[model samples]
Target chain A: MLFDKFKPMAEFQAELAARDVVPFGAVTEEIISATEGVVSGRRVILAGTNNYLGLSFDARCISAAQEAAGKWGTGTTGSRLANGSFEEHQALERELAAFYGVGHAISFTTGYAATMGMTATLAGPGEVILLDADSHASIYAGVQLSGAEIIRFRHSDPEDLAKRLRRLGDRAENTLIIVEGIYSMLGDVAPLREIAAVKREYGGCLLVDEAHSMGVLGDHGRGAAEAAGVEQDVDFIAGTFSKSLGATGGYCVSQHPELETIRYCIRSYIFTASSSPSVVASTRRALQILQEEPGLRQRLWENATRLYEGLQGLGLPVGPSPSPVVAVVLEDRSQAINCWNALMSAGIYVNLVVPPASPSTNFLLRNSVSAAHSTAQIDTMIAAYAGLLEDGLIRAR
Target chain B: MTQYQQYLEFMLSALEARAGAGVTLSETTRLVADIGLSSLEVMEFVEKIEDHFDISIPLNILPDINTLGDLARKLQEVDS
Candidate 1:
């Protein structure tokens, strides 16, 4: 009976197998560069990976990782509350805090853990969480585990948020408003300026998840809050090293002194092992590079605009705006699958998102552009989609 | 009218608007199986109900709801 719940997934897997199409989790045999990889015995452009700044293969980051590993051995071997509280972890925390100009910073083993821990622990039963309707799965999981009375507003609609807050009345002060800097699915930036204005009127703690927009937005690359000039109004800023920093970790920075105390109460942080020395080292190097080189961010935006314009020129249905993420919308699931397979055959790799996983009922062929992508690579991706359009695998809106 | 009855009436009209004018809707009418509402449609319907009642329904309650009666009763529980 417990296994019966997986029947739908099993059926889907069987269908894919029958079609000889592996859309999800296609393995990469070799990573030739930040922009290129070998998959299914064919070289393809790595467009689906969320390597926004493309510092994964940087020489400085690699050297820093090697040096840290040589000096500190391999893993931390324990949780931060136990024997895993190494000097490197604390240093990275301090560095993140300094980078955000916040009072406290806490790191987690994975980005999911950071968001989940913060969301679950920040508010408890008898409290409320007002989140965007199209929030990430991790945020949804956090709200469920928190036992909070969760309310979802229409996506990016500040008026809807204001209405919900009004309904809460005096209880609004006890609520936590969660929104992302750049929504991962559709590449739409949250109207943080309007959101912060609403928060000012309603009075609630604001938490912005800057996972996708941390290294891509803002003059100093802080995140959407910074770009919106609402950093002072935001109570907490959660972000990930896995995206822009090209490493594996997540963190939450806040100006409130209570975050230092809250870190001890987070079960995910206490129970999970700390990030390894090498990862911390590389992340530190990547953060430095992010600050030192503004050209990477510029290049990333240029590449994003190029890909978005290219698709739009071909009359493809793309996302609302062009950031580093550009997803083409599709109404037909089978047609989406066919286009994905065709792109792969044409030496390109992208993420195929279907219902529920996609923000809406429609499917999405998600592409994440990186600063490492050359102009040629961007054009090649465009040409592949054009071919799909020519072959009638996809149609314009 | 009882709160449950009011909720049922509202749900019936809503379902009728989507399913068709001549459709039948009872308290026991299944939302998905009988009326054929997709997940997105269900969420949209819930939002409409929330706005109508001026209530913030917790998403935690959706999984337990199968029929119009279940939704109405759950709505009454939240309203209380």
Candidate 2:
């Protein structure tokens, strides 16, 4: 039966219960403040959220969202191809294109939808899509839905990619190379310069997913493509507002004026309902803040470095380089779950990433730093890791 | 060196280029454990081997091949 197909979820939930740990998607009691939240009736420091710029609680964003809600009401309730194309939505798209210094932009309900619409429309049967082996699952799903021949190259290896393209011969012209600005799991920056160079050598298009890198990299916060000085070389750039902008939506920007045509053809964009008025408004405000205020980026980096170095001082296996995200790698599932529980008990909230979803075979405690975090809050998170280390709940790498 | 030996040397050098110059590899080396290669890196190594010989290594054979020696034997079978 249809219900029988979900038996594995039941078994997984039972296993998590047997381990006496909080299951995934545990509801918070309340958001105490911007940087703190109440989970299971305890005040916990929010270190797991994707509020990178920490604008979710910004006064200007809230005011804009409220004003838009009052002016446009709650939801659009229709697709952009139909009646859902509000004035604010078009305005956001224009603003986004200008912000990224691109020729065209199209916004979507979610980041997943942005990539889904792109891949499902970009390539058809017989065409090839070459992507990083460790690309996000959304990219995989997008390719699967597109019915394109999916080929994976070595992660961040340009020479390997060149070899694969050389094998493809003339089929290389139809290839689309996809890579992320910063991998979500490892928080490591991509070698965009080398990848762009390879794309130039081989006849192919390049798409950079900057979902995690936007508002965190570059002087203008245009993401890793801009930071690597290969912005003009990239053909497509997909990003999300949920992480840095503190809103729920995604967008694809390109220097090609033909990109606007996707709005009419892509099923995900044409059939699905557009983003709400408040989300669009708030996202626009946050985009302004992301550009106007460089101090937030500086504070975010400072906090990230402190947290990363602090975890290293405690002998933990943190991610390679310091970014807004600082992930601690664990050996096994039991160890990961145990540390997650220990951190929870100490009033620290972090993401528990397991196999399959994790980039590698290891479990991870994904910690994201926010610009809103104070020195005291950052200190508390570091001390929690130190305590876990002292208690032997976790070990050095 | 023989053709197979040259292929092995090429594979070792490719792995070392990413893993580091200090790394050492032999025919019996485990791709994941001994050399510290991620799943992506392993797939890339397989792709390089496939392109080198122009033979597609079926995914069904991946699970059985643990060491570089096993991979060499499998490639030999496919080559023949």
Candidate 3:
């Protein structure tokens, strides 16, 4: 009876196994490049990975990581509070603060820890948190643990956020508003300008999670806030090095002096071991590369546009706007699974998302483009999708 | 009718529309088990309730709520 709750999931896994469709956690046998990998015994174009800038396999980054590993060993054996605060960690923090033009920055072992810790610690009991309904699970977990009054406005609807704030009235000043720069599922972006304007009117601190948008957006790669020219309105920014920096870590940067004090109070930061020296070194190198090479961002955008246009030309239902992430929407679960399997068979790998993981009840075949994808590679993916349409596996929207 | 009764009446009507008119609703009726509302549908229903009552229901309270009576009681607490 203790395991009764897992029965449904077990049945679902069994069904998927019977169908020979392993959508989730398909192992990568060998990483050929930033944009190519041998997955499930087949060499496939890696489209589902969130490696936006494609710096994972850069020789410079690899060299930095190797050098750090040789100098500092493989891992930090203690938490930051204990003995894990290597000079590299502090240096990376300072660099992150400088990059964001913020007064303070704190790094975490994982993006989930950063977002969750910030969300949980920012507001407390009796205070309110107005978050987008489509927030990531990390944020939701943080809010549930925070003991704060968690109110979810409709996803990306500034009007709904305004309405909720209006109801709060005097309590609005104590509220924390949270939104992501680029939503993960559909690859849709938040209207940061409008949301920031609403925050200005409501008098609440705004936190923007730039996990997917950092190093992909803005002239300086400061994410949606910089792109929207509303950086001043944003109070805190949480992001991950895993996506763009091609490393494993997360950080929160803020102009507020209190952030330094708040760092001591975050259990996620205090209890967990800090990032290893190699990860920090590689992340620092990646950040430098991101700043020095603006052409990478341009190429990323161009690849995104090519994929978006190619999918649109095929009449596939894609996201609202063209970003590095392009997801094709489907209503039927079986059809979505078949299409995902078909793409995998065709040497193209993408993410198969079904509800309630998806933003809505619909299924999504999510593709993430990278700067490393050559024009020919992009066309190959498009051709494969076109084949799916011709086979009637997926219908044109 | 008291405000709580009015709220219950509205909820009953809404459930009847979704779960069929023949089904019965009471304070003990479980929203998910009895009415078969999916997670999304529950949120939509909560939004509808918030709009009708002109109140913002904190999602933090949902885990503690299961039966219709629990929701009505929680609504009353927040409404006040």
Candidate 4:
């Protein structure tokens, strides 16, 4: 038994099972139907997913991906160091760098990889990472991988950041300040302008992970940095093609030409296989469509606003305003599980996030609004939530 | 307040609040088999310490932590 060595995790596992929050993935839209699609059984609405842009099924994007595979073969077969850099990959990097209006950009195989490569490469032993308490697991894992001292401020509080930063004294110059454009679990925006101003005052570099917010924020969809009007001021912008672009991969763009220099030094990028040519190919097209079809941004905001309004009107614990993400906050873990299970049994699906994802237990019923979902689809979702409330399966906010 | 005394009161209130029910120990309490704190609750206690003392408690220090005094001693060391 690895239990002889790792005794405690098994205890945690038993707790998880008993809590009614199924740790295994079979409860909802990601359900397994034995090769038959859910349509043959019961139609399910996928709200728990992070498909913010909903371009995954776009005919053009899919066709372009298939076309690229025909042209470029299947896999890259190696890391980007040697035989892996495709015309698609190079072109995608160029398109992304131009998209963010930054001088250099590097793509990673996954959203996790982008964050790990930067945080681990930049900070090492004896250095510090000033992180938001609410930052994602990838960010936390990256800080751990970096071997840096991870210092946290209160969530989204720039005053806490400033005070904690002041404690590092002369070592502040060796600091990497990290925050999210929009926190994943909480569905809240950071005070980026205020946070950036403090980092600037203290002469620290800022790495903003716009994973959840990019292509959903700003009129132009540059991300929360642009939305906050600090695009030029931030040292690095790390975002996911997975979320807003409706594809899988991540990238970090920076004003520093030395940004590319980190690629050579970072182990995560150097060791792992590069993203498949098809993914890169699809993402490049997604970028083009992102700029051309600004109407998608408008539609996304419209859906998000509608959901926010519906939830708020229900007098639930919705987010403060028109965020692309909406969450119904709950306080008990069993209650959260009951609500999530009820949502699924009613053909609606949303993520049931619990702590360590957050401090609160019945934390969030996180639902994302996407461009592909129709007004009727959104209305159906709102109606389902209203029904959930009426059923008393999920408590009223 | 003695560092140990201040530590105990904070731990008692927060541990009682965050850990879901009353504890079976007092100021001299240890944090292992008696209470069965999940790793997360242990982390929460550490985070409370971090916030109270205005210091960064690296995650690496956690697995070895057992007794309340050990935690209090670590907090005092960090504070100094």
Candidate 5:
């Protein structure tokens, strides 16, 4: 009787199925997948997963993980403030600092938790949070929870941000400006140089979420800030290990030693259990491999360009700009579902983003190419989209 | 100008902008009837007001803002 109020799940599933956007998850995207269960009957050219650097399957990373598990016994059993701080965890923190050329770094359990902890520490009730309108949800929630007055600027428009800050006048000094490296849904990057300039002029701290661009951008893959050459300009650089590092955790790295003071105040860091030693070990190893190898990053960019231009050539209304993520825009919700189902039917699985997820704009098929993906896989993906375009499933002006 | 009259002008304009482009609105224009504030549209209007004035409009102020005059008067009072 207590469980009888679960009516929404059925309606949701029914509505989604009727529209045809069934969000399915799978294991991996090798020419031949190693796991069964999900992709058993699917041909899966796997383009939705955020494994940009393709280090999850790296032999060195797997070996490091196995060794760490043997040494640390699988779990940390406490928070970093308590008994969770292992020698490996401290080493990973140091490695992360050196990797980013910053003096301090603290790792969290997930990307969302990193943002939540970092933001909650930056602004208080009297302070203001000026965010880009299209920032990630974690950032939005973090500001909301911190009791900050969130003033959002137009997406990627620094002029709008300047106008908003001017409205705040003297109160702007207490403001924190937040932006992202590469937006997840549409796959567009922020105009960081202009944003950093404005934040500095306003005497505010800037936080850049490098979640989607780590291990994929920059000459050293130090994330998008490095790619933009504005590392020193930003106050807090928040990033996730889950996407490119092939682990589930987040880190807030900065040169400010006082940034470490947030360790005591951030609820997400204080409460959550520290990431497993195996995770840290793997990320460290992944970083080493990322630095040691440059060709992998090149292949990733090559694939991204191929898919993006291919979609454009097919005239399928790809996203406005070029990045690793290529989105096929279909404005109608049902059309997005149909296109998603069409991809799944072709044995190609990608993310089908709809209204709310797509910045209150249109529906889209969001895809990400990996460094591990070969030309053959890219060609197959392009050919499938070419078919869709020829059939007029995705229309263009 | 008197706060009442200033409030009247603001409401008339806000109602015209929010409800429709060419609607003739007066001081006593009911947000629910004349302007027709669906829950979503009401919140969007509240956002515009907050953004314009650079103030935090408490969520509680929403239910009481039933008319154009009421909204403008509330803004004046909050500003003061």
Candidate 6:
């Protein structure tokens, strides 16, 4: 049978069904209020969302989205190469390029496509791609599409990367090294300075995916590249609007004048429909908010530290640092599931990540902090976790 | 020892570092279940071998490889 090869997956699903825990495909009943939602018939605090700046429900952003939808209709209805590109889209691109202080910027439908399109088109035949071992799935998919030789250096180890690039020798000229600003699963930031140094010494293009770092790092929130003072060193910066921007789209900005060439070459850009008018409008407003209000970033980091310290105070295993994303490392899958269920029952929502997606073999309970979370809400979340620990629903390391 | 023999020994040493002291490794040993190397681990090991030999093995050659013997033979072929 055509489906016979997936017996193992079927068995796994059956096992999960018997356990009454379908961690995947969980549905939210409704979003009752900002940073509060109804899930599984209860009001839950949304601690697992990527709304870092918490601009998703901002009055200005909402108003812009509504006005844009009323003015330009909903979607572009065509690929950029055809009739999809609108004046608003180009304006957003210009705003983004100026935001990053780059010469050019290109927008895509989603952050995944930004990485996919840029990596897929940038490196060609006979070229090589050396990426961090713990890069996001979008990066892996992009490399696979490029049909270039893929080499993975040790995660965040510039020494290992240097060795690989040195081994490539003159072929390093055609090599593209990819890394991320903040790894989503573990919430660890990259050592961009070290990586940028390696790229400077070795002749290779450096692409930094700042999907999780933009609006969360640097004084101007340009991400790890700017935070590390290596903005000039990085050749390209890829980011998404879904997280901090409070919209749905992806963009790549570069100071390189040739970045315009990607518009004609990237398949993902040329084939798929552009972002909706509402999304572009809201994203532009969100960008303005991100810059104008630095307190949002400050409050976000404060909330992050509070949450990280709170989790640590409970003696639970946490990720390395206090970024917007805080991952609670678990010993096993059963333990992770139990903890997730317990948190859900307590009206606190968080994400449950397992193997393949997780950098290590262990499961992770990922909590993403936002600026909108009140001090009382943060304290409430901590108390819920404390209750879970007291009830023996979850364990400390 | 021949280059293939030396390479095999080096590969076995790297595997033992991860698999611990009691692992039984041979040229005919399956790199997956028998040695307990995940797909990602196998790829990393293959990359190490490529670096040691200063040869770029096409990614297409991966699936055809299962055992240490197969890897050694492929390395020899590429080097020659």
Best by DockQ: 3
Identify the runs in model 1 with alpha carbons over 4 angstroms from their true place: B17-23
A153-221, model 4: which lDDT tens digit per residue? 778899888987887788888899999998877568889999988988786789999999888877689
lDDT of 5 at A394: 69
Interface RMSD of each: 1.1, 4.8, 0.6, 2.2, 5.0, 3.2
Using DockQ, rank the candidates from best to worst: 3, 1, 4, 6, 5, 2
Per residue, candidate 6 scores C-alpha lDDT tens digits across A2-30 of: 99979977986787788777667777889
The top-ranked prediction according to TM-score is: 3
Worst 10 residues of 2 chain A by lDDT: A19-28
DockQ for all models:
0.76, 0.09, 0.91, 0.36, 0.19, 0.32
Candidate 6 chain A weakest ten by summed lDDT: A18-27
Could you tell me the TM-score of candidate 5? Answer: 0.87
CAPRI quality of model 5: incorrect
- Return model 1's CA RMSD, one decimal: 1.3
Assess candidate 3 and give its TM-score to the true structure. Answer: 0.98
Ranking according to TM-score, highest score first: 3, 1, 6, 4, 5, 2
**DockQ-best of 2 and 4:** 4
- Candidate structures ordered by lDDT, highest first: 3, 1, 6, 2, 5, 4
DockQ of 4: 0.36
Give every collision pair in model 6: none
Interface RMSD of 5: 5.0
RMSD of each: 1.3, 6.2, 1.1, 3.8, 4.0, 2.4
Model 6: docking quality category: acceptable
What are the chain A TM-scores for all the models, listed individually?
Answer: 0.99, 0.97, 0.99, 0.92, 0.93, 0.98
lDDT of 5 by residue, A81-197 (tens): 899889988898899889888899998989999997787678988788888878888887788787776666778999878887887789889989999998888888888888888
Clashing pairs in 3: none
Residue A382 lDDT (model 2): 95
lDDT of 1 by residue, A238-356 (tens): 98999999999999999999999999999889998999999999999999999999899999999999999999999999998888989999998789888999999999999999889
